[model samples]
Target: MCSNYDACTKPERLRMYFGVEPPPRIKSQVWPLYEAPFIRRHPHKDVGDDAVPAREAVAGLFGLIPHWAGEMTFGRRTYNARSETVAEKPSFRDAWRNGLHCIVPVECIYEPDWRGGKAMPTRIQRKDGKPIGIAGLWTSNTKATGDEVFSFTMLTVNADDHALFKHFHKPGDEKRMVVILREDQYDEWLDAPASRSMDFMRQFPAELLMATAEPDRGKKTR
Candidate 1:
């Protein structure tokens, strides 16, 4: 599960890679509950069904807030939804059944490597050094104060058989990875129906990914 990641906040990269404009402000590094940009199909009403632009970028919390959530804190544990149970999980089913698909533009995702008997932070990114679009679901919630809040959750798939991702997490725990969609599949993912959404929940090729150890220097006490 991806609990930490860097958001792609560069306006030029957001436009050239995701084909959407950047939000006014977004955190460079995002954790659960942090606001970040996500791309989804523009509402038909806004485009009159004949507009040229098909996608739009909107800022939303990194964690998904289910409609039934009594408080925003509920999102902390929902930042990553298992693809296998997303369609049935109470926290994610509504967004899945409604096809509220979205693409999370990420600079890189942080994972733990425990090969050396200790957890080492690893930064994974495309081999070509380009931003990646991760598959996710987005939802809108109304607070008691009558304010609307948008949130999203990244979709993850089993990675036991994946060459690279199979090494993440712990030595014995089942490995998992986020679904990184190909550039050509971004539109298809956003437009696919709920039934067909599963077809895009597969793992990205290992060869296209590169990982390097990036231990947290801030953790060292003076």
Candidate 2:
């Protein structure tokens, strides 16, 4: 539930860390990241619209693969393609067929509490400015150019202790959070599946996350 991040007030910080510029206007109730064209730094590699990596795992925009595609809208259905059942659902089954692979580069994600007296906004981020990748599933969407445009959904699993203890999540519900991956886990998550996916996901350390409140701009730190 680390959703309360407002303005990317630290634009200069983002630029320094990401090496790419921040959004022209730093805003969004829910931030938007899209597939755009880019040239990679590696002189030997190819760079183009299809080559650009996604900024964040924007849920559901990317559909599941091997689509039976019986007249379904992409946006509504694609938002959450869970890891546990990706192999079972018809929509995602084929995606799981060859094994779905995707990465969502997230700044932060927020969640609200309807039962609370006053809603609190918290901003969660790594202490270091290292850009992290959240695991996801992707399908190839065709664009006018005929180059395969890939859209993906970030995977979510039960929240760890930090989140449950932070006054978020349903009382008894295991509740879910986006699956943020450690650098070491990327290969398996984006490569192997079914057998290895669950095992690799469990490797995340519970102690790495610090979920807390964002106080007023002065005096206190989030």
Candidate 3:
């Protein structure tokens, strides 16, 4: 699962790439619960049957906040919802069935390799360094204070057989990676029915992937 990532896209680039208006400037890096932009169909308030889904860019927290959550802290652990069980998991099932699909724009994602008795942070991205659109589910919550919280969780699939992805996570843990949609597949992914959405959950070609080892700044000092 991804604990942090780089999603720093400029407003103009967001418009150029996703065709939606830009959200607020995101930091160079984003962590769980940090707000970031996502492309998704806007919630329609029109009562008419003529209403259509409109694509829009909106800022939402990286972690999902199920409407049933009594508090926001639960988001910390829901940043990623496994694709295999998302349709059945209580936290994500509702959104999954309701077609709350979203696309998370990521420049790169960070993971920890615990092979040498300690974790080494690795940055994974497309070989060309272009932003990748990760498939995700989003939901909204209203706080007691009248504030509304919009959040999302990236969907991941097993990547055990993937040459590149299988190298990131801890040794004994299951290998998994976020579902990255090709540019041509974005529209289909966003508009597909819930029943057909999972059909798009598959491993990306490792040939297009690249990785770099980085110092683990979060590692404790002696």
Candidate 4:
């Protein structure tokens, strides 16, 4: 479950990698409710009478708020959706079934490691030190003033047996972590049918990940 992360990639870099228009400059770091870039499927009009689906990088809130939710506060608890129950959860079921998928790009993710029987802030990144894509679900909510709010929630999977991820959570709590998608699989994730999407929710390779501890910070929620 990734609640905060580094989004230090320059807008030009994102445009080159995702092939979408450059997004506005983002902060060096992002927390819940912060606006950041996420890639989603969009329609592209060609010369003829044909429209093709293309990936586009757009800015959106980190937490999702279904249109049906009455208050924005609900988003505070929806920064992450469990992979196993996403299809059944009320807040995410509609978006999941509607194929509202997106990819969260980040330089690294922050988590808490309890290996020392005390929470320690840790930053997890790709061993190659490149930006990674986190699988997520997105939706649009209309405010009473008619303004539309676009947001997303990262998908997470149990990591009880994962060598690196399993050490993040508390000793007695179930271990969980976000599903990091490989670069090659990003397109498929955005267009795949909901019925087959679950197949992609697998644990990230621990060997490909590197974790470094920072000074302990106050507890953060996922």
Q: Tell me each candidate's RMSD, in Å, in order.
A: 2.6, 7.4, 3.6, 2.9
Per-model TM values vs. the true structure: 0.94, 0.59, 0.89, 0.90
The 10-residue segment of model 3 with minimum total lDDT is: 45-54
Which candidate leads in TM-score? Answer: 1
Ranking by lDDT: 1, 3, 4, 2
lDDT of 2 by residue, 1-222 (tens): 222223322445444443334433333233223231111122222455655542322222333323434333443355555667767877676665666565544555455432365545555555564554566666654532254444455566655464333355545555566677876655556557556656544324445655556543232132
Candidate 3 lDDT over 167-199, as tens digits, reads 877777899999999988888888888989889
> What clash count does candidate 4 reach?
1
| C-alpha lDDT (0 to 100) for residue 210 of candidate 3 | 88
Q: Give the lowest summed-lDDT range of ten residues in model 2.
A: 36-45
Clashing pairs in 3: none
Name the Cα RMSD for model 1: 2.6
Alpha-carbon error at 122 in model 2, in Å? 2.9
> What overall lDDT goes with each candidate model?
0.91, 0.47, 0.83, 0.82
Measured by lDDT, the strongest candidate is 1
Give the lDDT of residue 47 in candidate 1: 50
Give stretches of model 3 more than 4 Å off: 44-54, 143-145, 216-222
Q: Which stretches of candidate 2 lie over 4 Å from their true place?
A: 1-66, 70-72, 113-115, 142-149, 160-166, 212-222
Displacement of the residue 27 alpha carbon in candidate 2, Å: 8.8
Per-residue lDDT, model 1, residue 219, is 37
Evaluation by lDDT, superior candidate among 3 and 4? 3
